[model samples]
Target chain A: MLEALRKISDVVWELPVTHKAGMRVPARIYGTEKLLQEMDEAVFDQISNVATLPGLVKHAICMPDGHFGYGFPIGGVAAMDTEEGVISPGGIGFDINCGMRLLTTNLTAGEVEPYLKSLVDLLFGRVPAGVGSRGSLSLSRTEFRRVLEEGAHWCIENELGRPEDLARTEEHGRIAGADPSLVSEKAIDRGIHQVGTLGSGNHYLEIQAARPADVYDPELARAFGITLPNQVVIMFHCGSRGFGYQVASDYLKVFLKVMEASYGIKILDRELASAPFRSPEGQDYFAAMKCAMNMSFANRQVILHRIREVFADVLGRSAEDLEMHMVYDVAHNTAKLERHLVDGTPRELLVHRKGATRAFGPGAEDLPAAYRETGQPVIIGGSMETGSYLLAGVSSGDQAFFSTAHGSGRTMSRTKARRTWRGRELWREMEERGIYVRTASWAGLAEEAGAAYKDIDEVVEATEMAGISKRVVRFTPLGNIKG
Target chain B: MPYEFLEDVATADIAFEAWGSDLEEAFSAASEATLNVMVEEPGAVRPLETREIHLEAEAVDVLLLDLLQELVYYKDAEQLMLRVDDLEVTGGPPFRLDALARGEHLDPERHRPRVDVKAVTLHRFRVEKTDRGWRASVILDI
Candidate 1:
């Protein structure tokens, strides 16, 4: 049974607290009417279930890309009082800190067009990808622990990147409170050889072009070094590699037991198993989770170093001349301690963004000084065949705990996509469109075909119109490396 | 009874599903199937070492996730390819479990991963009973 949606605005709809049992707050969804109609009813049910969790503050929000996920919708956002609320693994997702990083180069598409294939090959050789892929850098147990705690800072210390790179990253590349001891030996072993690797699925490294229509503001483009039509840029998406995976696996076992004994909270979905934020188990998981976040940060930083190396080798130019500066790095799957306005009063909350992005508006104190005026750059990745987007945070995101959509959101099942599309044909099509693709598995490639997801442009438009975030620029893919 | 492998990806209706009569049997079958989803053969895994595993979950599905994660942990960290020998699950707010898993050193020819399951997800997860026996379905966070 479904309840009538209460319209908050043309783009906002609310599921009242009365819609479900044990609901501590309402559930709000931001989407256009067309997009809302496309969503399954279960997405609403999951959002309602999230609202029912104890100590939830404000509303459980779903961005325009919202779709049915584990306990919470994929594009779900929820903030809970850190002192009294709960933390669920489902809210943080499996790939901890699975995020996007944008790199801006001084070269235009015309300058790189002749050497696109060579550049793609160099990048493919440098970045190890695909399922169960291992990287060139292998760390011992001691070094692995240090990497977990220091994140990108560790890479910078090792001369993999410059000091300036840390300031442009979220949380300055290291999340505090990470305890390496909490990580299990098994987790440590799994992650030792996986740093700088791009593990399979939707993760990718891409070269893109910014067209004139894609550029929202000319001045903004000029400032960001994205001035010319068909300017070349790089955007890569990945996470803490195997390290994050192992951390989540180890902690979920602990949390499952803690939820049962401590809270007596019975959830219909096993994936929604959770614990009170104040509990010892909760603290332990948070600490270990932060370690995973840091590990991923280091992984991305190392990959960026590899990218820089490949560019220098192929272009025959100094790294400085390439101007491969990081535009921004933002996490899509994470839970962060944040302060937000709830009912016009400031409250400390543990904000969980599963398949969502933190879209902090302009003048946010947390933002780096260089980006404070432009707000957080929300990199929304689409499939390899389609285009990705860059969006700026809007003030209205404060109502949703400063959250927005992460990606295009899957509309078709992987099985269906694989059955309908052929990898070879898809690869040829992308090649015809001047997009080079390097993939490990044909079946995996078929599963990630662009047709399997909703239109990214439509999804971003809905988010912008809903006031959750505003579009900044579009980057059309020129080449992609997928695992 | 003979066992058969089922190929259900983490998706809408056709997720990773398994069936058996009792809790141990249901869990064992599900564990075997989950490993099969990652690799080609679970039966080919010889019992090289035996490990004791005790886990707790809020429900049957959570219990399944814990169970599967343990196997993944063993496979990835220890380089052991495992198959569940026994599984017993008790239900409550905090469910308890006792399990035995056995695996040999990784044999590349026998065990090649189809996909790396980053983690097990609670999204659209369900474990219930049908007229024939018990059944469970879960979406892996890949």
Candidate 2:
């Protein structure tokens, strides 16, 4: 009942446009044969479904880490005509603006290794995490609304972070056109007390060891003040918390009813419900979604401030000497207005990257001036046990809408994983391997055991071989705090 | 009928196994199990009135989501507590459903808050039948 896949190249495979009805474009998957075979067949079906959406340009692409997801496979990328296309919540995913951030510190791992446990404890005490977790900072309804609008800029204005930090963040730490009025009351209530909290499941704060001195670019490392083989750095992965969840929830309900009545777009799945870009409902959802994205930027900014305080207090070093500089921040789940080449002609498109990262190549005008020559930094978070990676977008990604993999995709189902491993045993094993972990639930630990995911090295290798992004540095985890 | 709860870090999946000669009974039993994930008491709410609800879905998985979201919408927006009464699923290119839901006014003390069903994820979703009756397995986006 399925068509045979056509091999486009060693690192590329194509599902011809005719494989599915109503397809506007073909589907291209970037990965090696081994990685491709490991993927679930459902991924092809999902990607093909994405291609069938109206006004889809070029191809519907799946990164090496691609896996089965709602409408767009996780790690899927697609560009649509801004004037005539549609936007689906399934394409951006439920966790709007889920992203990663990296910070460099002056202290070497040797200096902090002795007090790593204490540092992890302090961090755990400061940043609230876990399911239904609430933070110490309680915002009045008005202040909460302001945070939804101002984003990380609000954090910097409140002295939580340095103003310069915003320059290194995607979209300068805030996306424009966010309308707080579009956010529902239920969404506002859900996010009011959750600003600085880290909601459970795959969100974490980890301390990692930098790559060997010779492996990193000397000039860039020096500019970023990152040096020494055993340098201690902080990396975290989280999102807009309850705010993003509520935003997606509110819109999905609205879209479900409106899409049928307005556009006559019949989807194969309710999860893929969508509305035309020109519709009022679509514009409102985009604005509200942007507000949630800004809220996440502020959440991570506050967490970074807390990390700085803990480092200064425990190390007895001045904030200046700690030299905690934000290297980069990138979102994994989002749909943005971008310019891309469509059939050799430049056009504006709405690019949807669900569980994928925008890896714009060097000299992109949108990149910060400092990074113009090197390209945007791409942060790929591996499982806590395997550590994470820092990569730079390369020129070849220009042909693929400038996107790359977000992480090592899930390989095993959680049910099978929990049955095979015990939480306590897994915790002890990670500690024995020199990775300290602080978590609120042991059951959660078992579900996220390293064995549950694919090999990050192989996923990254596939991306690199496909000319999407190039690895700059590899980090080994020393300690982690999970929600 | 028996149901088993499966655990995931982000969401929880439960498997409902029921035996019935007809489709309506199996649908009723499965619906009961699905709501059971959110509350401890299924029979505590007095049946004040019965309302007929209809839904059309593209697949069995989406039908399940549409059914659950309808219940959630009633609970949140309309302040109604509901349990499936009579239900039927006619599967085709577009699955059609006819159902009745019974519930009373909200008694806050009787119903305790559980995990929020943020969204119905397509991750690891399955619905199949066994020798006994029918089974539907789903992962809720919590």
Per-model C-alpha lDDT, please?
Answer: 0.81, 0.78
Instruction: List candidate 1 stretches off by more than 4 Å.
Output: A1-3, A266-268, B1-14, B19-32, B39-67, B78-113, B122-136
**What is the per-residue lDDT of model 2 for residues B1-142, given as tens digits with 9 covering 90 to 100?**
3455554322122223433455556556556655554444656777886778898877765676677656654553344667887688897659898898998655535643223334555455566666765666655664
| lDDT by residue for model 2 (A209-256), tens | 886842445555544446677778899988887678768877887898
Worst 10 residues of 2 chain A by lDDT: A214-223
Candidate 1 docks at the CAPRI level of acceptable
Task: Compute the interface RMSD for candidate 1.
Answer: 3.7
DockQ of each: 0.32, 0.14
Please give the distance, in angstroms, between residue A76's alpha carbon in candidate 1 and its true position after superposition. 0.9
State the weakest 10-residue window (summed lDDT) of model 1 chain A: A217-226
Model 1 pairs whose backbones collide? A70-B123, A271-B122
For candidate 2, what is the DockQ-based docking class? incorrect
